[model samples]
Target chain A: MLKINDLHASVEDKAILRGINLHVKPGEVHAIMGPNGSGKSTLASVVAGKEEYEVQSGEILLDGENIDELSAEERAHKGVFLSFQYPVEIPGVSVTNFMKTAINETRKAQGLKEMPANEMLKMIRQKSELLEIDRKFLSRSLNEGFSGGEKKRNEIFQMAMLEPKLAILDETDSGLDIDALRIVANGVNKLKSEDNAVIVITHYQRLLDYIVPDFVHVLYEGRIVKSGTKELAHELEAKGYDWIKEEVGV
Target chain B: MSKYTEDDLREELKTKEYEYGFYTDIESETFPVGLNEDIVRAISKKKEEPEWMTEWRLEAFRSWQEMIEPEWANVHYEKPDFQAISYYSAPNSKPKYDSLDEVDPELLATFEKLGISLDEQKKLAGVAMDVVVDSVSVATTFKKTLAEKGIIFCSISEAIQEHPELVKKYIGTVVPQKDNFYAALNSAVFSDGSFCYIPKGVRCPMELSTYFRINQAGTGQFERTLVIADEGSYVSYLEGCTAPSRDENQLHAAVVELIALDDAEIKYSTVQNWFPGDADGKGGVFNFVTKRGLCEKNAKISWTQVETGSAVTWKYPSCVLKGDNSVGEFYSIAVTNNYQQADTGTKMVHLGNNTKSTIISKGISAGKSQNSYRGLVQVSSRAENARNFSQCDSLLMGNLCGAHTFPYIEANNKTAKIEHEATTSKIGEDQIFYCNQRGIDTEKAIALIVNGFSKEVLNKLPMEFAVEAQKLLEISLEGSVG
Candidate 1:
């Protein structure tokens, strides 16, 4: 569903992703694990077409179309989604209104009319139910004063609303407790299907136990240095990333 | 992708044109350019005012001659040449229109172009409109409906002729002749504005609105609005203005006064959209207005204004709580873009015991404009237990713009409780990216962010006016970001 060839990206003359490559097919769950500052979030942001990060010498493709020239919003219209590591706080916009605007705008970009108000409400209710979000929480300002777990869950709620084909959960498990992690992982697992894909990026292996990935890749420095199955997560959790660093002689 | 820097946003903001820049070709009988005692007398004579009114104008003119233009505002502008502007200009035909068909077609077209057709306003919005062109009120709608409820609504000139007792008792009672430099000038040579009076124990059936337009090129617009809510009465008044694009700065110095008698309530709102000149700041309106209200015992007064135009603006709508347990409120959203400068806020004076006041100000500055909020809260020694809360927030769109706050508080009463809070924030790139990633464009994202920032103040507006104000904010900031 998504392809990245020789992905070299930087921000303000500082290279972050150097010659990284990744490919993910539909219906497959891919886990990209790494220590701090290993370009995990940068890869997600680049795929989402963040303007600050310049694609120095690489290309990203979604559904066999070169999306390097598309804007972040255009990419979103074409079914690309990125769950931000830290959600922004918009003080006066309710989560429902924000979702409505996002959904309507994406529909508008595709030459469709705005979603019917009743249908939008129904979808919101269904998604919030799927994610176990409070009804009152949808009316509060977007992410303003939200707890860390609530923010992460809200990001997942948005992913469910957009129903993007390629969803990149960048550090979604960072601030979640055990219960919250189970709920978030359960929500992601239910939304999985054959026509879409999920890429989970995390620093720890605790989340893999809930939303068990089919493939695990360890990203060190700027590139993925090792690839294995679900058992590799338990292996790394028992040991540590130091063994991988030694194996890569870094 | 190409880099969309702040410089690019600044360039885009500069390219936006003022939408209401079209001039109407109407023949007008314009007074010669100059201001003196004789000119003030001539204006009073043109209105055929009573002898006392003429003497009042002369007194104001005398005070104005002695008063120099104040320069204390946080604004920089080439001082307007007062003598170079025509003091009065009215359309040639002065016949009173009995109905819409009797009005001038060209004049109706002007209102239509302004998106305020009198016929539509009367039929649809149920709003009584006093349409003022140049310095003369051309049409006053829904007068009979308002008069049915003992609500006196008409032009100031009509009110002076027909209801002199009410006009004489309240005119200049709140903002006197020597209130300030602009107030003195406006009091001296003001031509026309709306005057509304809600009778005792009566509520106005509909919104009282006045739409001021400056069509003549060189004439200065000086309008004086007076609203009086008698004992146990209630009223809501709205005022809006716009001017044609010109190469020289035109002057718009207006004075508004409100009186809320014992147990009465008054709500006054202004959506000022005067011409804001071109991108280079060549010409626009010099808006220096004085608006103040007086609240009697147990009375309440509220002022809500959304200001988005003018090259240079200096306005402060204030309330004086004179009676015990009275309330005052001020809610404002001021937007400036592309060389526009606005210094606007409100003043709350707690002279009565146990009185309260609240102020919410939102200023949005884009392009190279400068926006400032200057407010004052004063609690007198006799005002025991007076309380006031104020919040001033500013949002800047680009690096070249500026926002400033000047808050003054004076509490003499030991029991007074006053609190003030302020914040200044820029539209962060992360916020924009978040919206963009959700499929919203840059322009739509800016509109969303700004409307969010201004939701508090916008909520205070009347439902219809709130929608228009929101649209105005979006239009004012169009192309302000990539």
Candidate 2:
């Protein structure tokens, strides 16, 4: 569903991702693991078409089409979703209204009529039930004064509403407790199908315990040093990233 | 989600055009650009006012000549040439129309373009209206229904000729002739405005509204609105205005006063959408007006205004809480776009025991415009246990626009409790990105964010006006951000 080759990205003249490469196929989960500042989140951001990062030399493809020229919103309209690390707080726009606008806008971009009000409400009800979100919470302003877990859950809730083909979970599990982690991972696991995929970017293996990955790539110094099976995650958990840093020789 | 650039969106909005710029082909009697005692006398004579009214206008004219225009507001614009503006202009037709059918067809067409068609306005049936074209009232609707309830609703000119006793007792009582430069000018040569009076111990059964439009090219609009809620009475009054598009700047200086007697309550709202010049601010309305209200014992008064259209605006609607246990409220949302400049706020004076007041002001500045909220909350010594809470927030759309808050508070009572809070924020790229990531484009994102920012104040407007105000905010902020 997604492909990145020779991905060299930087922000403000400082190189972050140097010659990184990854291929995400449908019905499969890819876990990218790296220590702090090792360009793990940067990779997720680049894949989602964040404007801050400059692609010094790289190309990205979505479903075999070059997406390097697409804007963040256009990428989203083409079924790319990024769960932000720190969601913004819009004080007076309720979560429900925000979701309605997002859903309708995406539909509009695809040349579809607006969803009927009753169907929209039913969809909201079913999705909120799947995510264990309160109706009252859905009426509150988007992420304003929301707890860390609530923010992550709301992000996932939006992801569920959009049903993007390629979902990049960028540090979505760091701020969540074990219960919220279970709920979030459960939501992702349920939504996974043969036509969609997810890339979980995290520093630890905690989230992997809930949603096991098909492959694990250990990244060191902005390059994927090792690619292996799920056993590599437990191995990395046993030996910290320092061991990997030594293996890569700085 | 439009694929257009911010500049494209701005162009689309500019094409929205000053919808009221269309002129009506009608003969008008106009005065030359100058103000003197003779001009004031001529206006009064044209209205056929009684002797006392003419003398009072002359006195106001003398006071206006001695007063200097204020320059303390946080706005910069070329001072208007008052001597070059026609003081009075009226459609050379009958002053009063017995029915909507008798009104000029072109004048009625103007109202239709403004979205308050005369037929629809009358069909609403729940609202009584005083429709003023240029400087004279052409029709006062639902007079018979209002009069049956001992409620007097008519043009100020008709009020003077019919109910001289009440008009004399209230005119210039709340906002005096020498109160301010613009107020004095309005009092001197003001042509026509709405006058509403509710009897003692009666609640007005329907809404009373006045629509003011400036049709002639060079004439300014100076209307006076007075609303009196007698003892234990209640009323809600609404005023809205528009002006035709012109390259030459027009001036709108008016006075509005309200009086609430013991146990009475008055609520006044204004949706001012005068022409807000072209993108370069070549020409538009310069709105300088004074509005004030007085509350007697156990009375309450509230002012709610949504100001979105004016090249330059200087207005402050205030309240004087003179009655014990009286309440005062000011809820406003002022939007300035392109080169428009607005300096608006409210003043609350708590002079009676146990009085209270609340102020919520929201200012949105976009497109190199400047918007400011200057408010004052004063508590006198006799105002024991007086309380006031004020919240002023500003939202900036781009780096070039500006938003300022100047709050002045005076407390002399030992038991007075006052709280003031303010915040200023910008539309950050991150917020826009968040929305974009959810599939909303920058233009819709900005509109959503702005509407959210101004929701608190917009919620206070009447339903019909609230929707219109919300749409206005969206249009004003378009292309403000890229």
Candidate 3:
């Protein structure tokens, strides 16, 4: 579903991701875990085509097509979604209206008619129910004064609405409590399909417990140091990232 | 339901022509450059004003000659060459027309393009419209219906002729002739505007409105609007303006005065879309207006405005709470894009006991424009228990634009309760990316963000004009700096 070869990215003059090569086939869930200063989040951001980051030397292919030149919005129209850790607070724009704009814009880009109002409403109702989001919550201003859990849940709600082919959950679990984590994890699990993929980037293996991954890669010093199956997450959770840092030997 | 492609929309936005840019091809009786008592007398005589009206205009002309233009606003522009602008220009046609069909084809076409044709407006049910072209009113609709209800709605010129007593008693009563330099000039040589009067205990069943169109090349448009809500009456008046595209800046100095007598209520709304100059800030309207309302015992006055046009806008619609338990409110959203500049707000003067006032102002600055909100809230010594609440928020779209606020509050009565809150926010790149990541383009995202930022003030507009104001905000900031 997604392929990155020698992904060397930098923001400003500082190199973040030195050399990253990763491949995720369809229906695969990959978890990338690293300590605070590692390039885990940077990898997610680079793949999503954030313009601030310079892809110094990299090739990102989506379905075998080079997407390096695509804009963030274009990437989104091509079924790439990023669930921001900190969703923007757009006061006075209701969540429903924001989603409407997003949906219509994507449909417009794909040369499709706008979803009928009733269908959109029904979709919102069914999807929001999947996340246990109150109906009134959908009418409030988009993330303005929303609690941290609500913001993360809203991010997942948007992810559900867009139903992207490749979803990047960048630190989506950092601000969630136990119940919110369960709800968000459940929502993502229900949306997973053989034709879709999710790249989970987290500091701790805590989120991996709720949304188990098919594979785990230990990222340290801007490169993947180890790759293993789901037990690697349990091992990292039991021990710590210190073992990997020591193994990399600075 | 939609046929436009994104390319077509982009092409249309690229042209960005002033939608109301067509100039009427009519022979106009215009005055030559210069100003004096003779010019004022000529304008008054042209309107066939009553003797008292003529005398008041002469007095204003004398006062204007002695007044120096104030320079305290936060806008930068070359001072206009007042001596070079024609003080009066009116279409060479008769005053009264029986129906919209009788109006000149060219003049009617102008309104049609503006989407406010008399027939369309009459179909709007309860809106009485006075269409002012250049410096004279060419169409007045729903006058008969309004008159039958003891409501006076007509051109100021016609009001001076038919309801001279009301005009004489109310003109300059709220915003006096010498209130400011522009007000003095408008009082002196003002040509025509809408005049509305609601009789005692009578609630006007319609929205009294006027559409001022500046068509001539170099003629200045001086309009005077007066609305009076007599004792225990209620009225809501709305006015909007547009000007033909001109390379050289045109001057528009208008004065609006409103009076709400005892137990009366008056609501005034304005959607000002004067021609903002070209991208380089070459030609546009220099809009300098003075608007104020006087509230009597237990009366209420509210001013709601959406200012999205003009090369340079300097207007402060204010309220004077003069009687016990009176109230005042100001809700505004001012947008300045390109090289446009605006320094507008309101003044609430509390002179009566327990008088209350509320102010909400939102300013959006894009491109290299500058937007400022300058307001004053004053509580006099005897205004015990007077209360005022003010909120002013500014949203900056690009790094190049500027937003400023200057709120002056003076409380002489120790018992007065005054509170103010203000915030300045930037349209962060992350915010834009958030929308982009959701598949919305930059243009549509910006329009959504801006509309959201000003929703509070936009909500205060009349039902029909809110949609127009929202569109104006988008068009004004279409191709912004960022």
Candidate 4:
């Protein structure tokens, strides 16, 4: 469902992703693990079409179509979603209003009429219950005063609302407590389907316990140095990334 | 970003004239471009003012001549060459028609071009309008119906002749003729504007509105409006203005005064969209206005404005809390894009004990525009237990634009309590990307963010005007997104 060939991206002349090659088929979950500054988050940002990053040479294809020229919004309409590392606080805009606008905008791009208010409210309530989010959170300003755990959970809740074809979770477990982490992972696990793909980018293997991945890739210095199965996550969690850096002579 | 020299910056500031600039070829009765005792008397005579009104105008004119233009506002513009501009320029043809159908087609066309629906069939229900073209009130609607409720609504000129005693008692009472430079100039040669008076113990039956359009070139429009709410009465007055896009900057100096007596309430709202100069900031309207209201004891007055146009706007619609337990409120959202510049806010003067006031100002600056909020809150010695709360926020779209806040607070009574909070922020790229990732384009994202910034102020407007103001904010910020 997604392919990245020799993805070389840089921001402000500083290369962050150097020749990254990856692919994921439908219904599969892939996890990318790396230490801080190892380009794990950069990889997710590059895939989401952030304009600040310069893709010097490479092409990204989604569903066999070149999408490098598409805007972030166009990519979203094409069912590509990114769970932000740090959710933005948009004051005075209620969460429900924001979600409704996003949902209607995506539907409009797909040439579909807006969902009825009652139906939309019902879906939101169901999703909130699944994500363990209180109904009052839906009426407050978008993440205005939410804690770190609340923010991460809200990101997962938004992911559920958007229902993108390819969901890229960037460090979704970084600030979550044990229970919040389980709930977020459970939400992502429940969203899995045969025609969709999920890529979990994290530094810790603890999250892998909840939403197990079919494949794990170890990234270092902007390159994917090793690829293996779910056991690879446990190996790295025990040995840590420094052993790999020493083995790779970096 | 490319480094530009001084010449490049100068070129960047060159502005173009936008769409509203088609001038009509109608003849007009204009006074010479100067002011004197005779000119003031002539204007009064032209309107057939009552003897007492003529004397009152003369007194204001003399006081205005003695006052100096205030230099306190955070605005920079060449002092207007008042002696070189025509102040009273009315259309030559007078409407002799006994009904709205007989109003001149040319004048009606002007209003239509300004996007104001004047046709009887298109008029909104429960909305009465007074149309002011150039410097004269051409036609007033729902006059008979309004009169049936003892509500007197007409042009200032007509009020002077019809209700001279009322006009004489209230003119310049709230905002004196010598209040400021522009106010003094307006007082010296003010032409005509709307005059509304809700009788004692009566609530106005409809929304009273006045539309002011500047149609002639090189003519400076000085309009004076006065609205009075008698004891226990209630009224809502709305003012909407538009001017033809002009390459040469046109001067508009208007003064509006409002008075709410004991147990009365007044709500005044304005949607000011004068011609903002082109992208380069070459030609537009220079709007210098003074608007103020007085709330007597137990009375309330509120001012709500959405100012999105004008090349340079310098106006402060203030309120004077003179009666105990009276309330004053100001809600404004001012947007300046391109080369437009605006320095506007309100003043709250508390003279009676237990008075209260609230001010909320939101400014959005994009492109190379400059927006500032300058406000003052003064509590008198006798205003014990008075309270005021002020919040001013600015949103900058890019680094090129500027946003500033200048708040002046003075408390003389030990029991007075005042609180102020202000914040300035740029629309970060991450926020834009977050919205874009939700299938919202950059333009729509910018609009959404701006609307959110102005939600507090916009929500204060009347229902219909709030929607109109929201649409205006969207259109005004076109191409402002990165």
- Expressed as tens digits, the lDDT of each residue in B285-359 for candidate 4 is 999999999999889999999998898999888989999999999999998888889999999999998999999
lDDT of 3 by residue, B364-477 (tens): 887778999999999999999999999999998756679999999999999999999999998777887788788887778879999999888888888888888888888776
Q: lDDT tens string, model 2, B102-187?
A: 88787777778778887777787577788888878888888898888899998899899999999999999989999999999999
After superposition, the stretches of candidate 3 with alpha carbons farther than 4 Å from their true spots are B1-19, B480-482
Task: Find the number of clashing residue pairs for candidate 3.
Answer: 0
Location of the lowest summed lDDT over 10 successive residues in candidate 2 chain A: A44-53
Off by over 4 Å in 2: B1-21, B98-101, B480-482
* Per-residue lDDT over A116-227 for candidate 2, one digit per residue giving the tens place of the 0 to 100 score: 9999999999999988888899999999999999999999999999999999998889889999899999988888899999998888899999889999998776788888
lDDT of each residue in B272-390, candidate 1, tens digit only: 88989899988999999999999999999999999999999999999999999999999999999999999999999999999999999999999889999999999999999999999
Between prediction 2 and prediction 4, the one with superior DockQ is 2
What TM-score does candidate 2 reach?
A: 0.94
- TM-score per prediction, in order, is 0.98, 0.94, 0.95, 0.94
DockQ category of candidate 1: high
- Candidate 2 residue B129 Cα shift, in angstroms, is 3.3
Model 1, runs deviating above 4 Å:
B480-482
Fnat across every predicted model, in order: 0.80, 0.68, 0.68, 0.62
Clashing pairs in 4: B14-B280, B15-B280, B15-B281, B15-B282, B20-B245, B21-B245
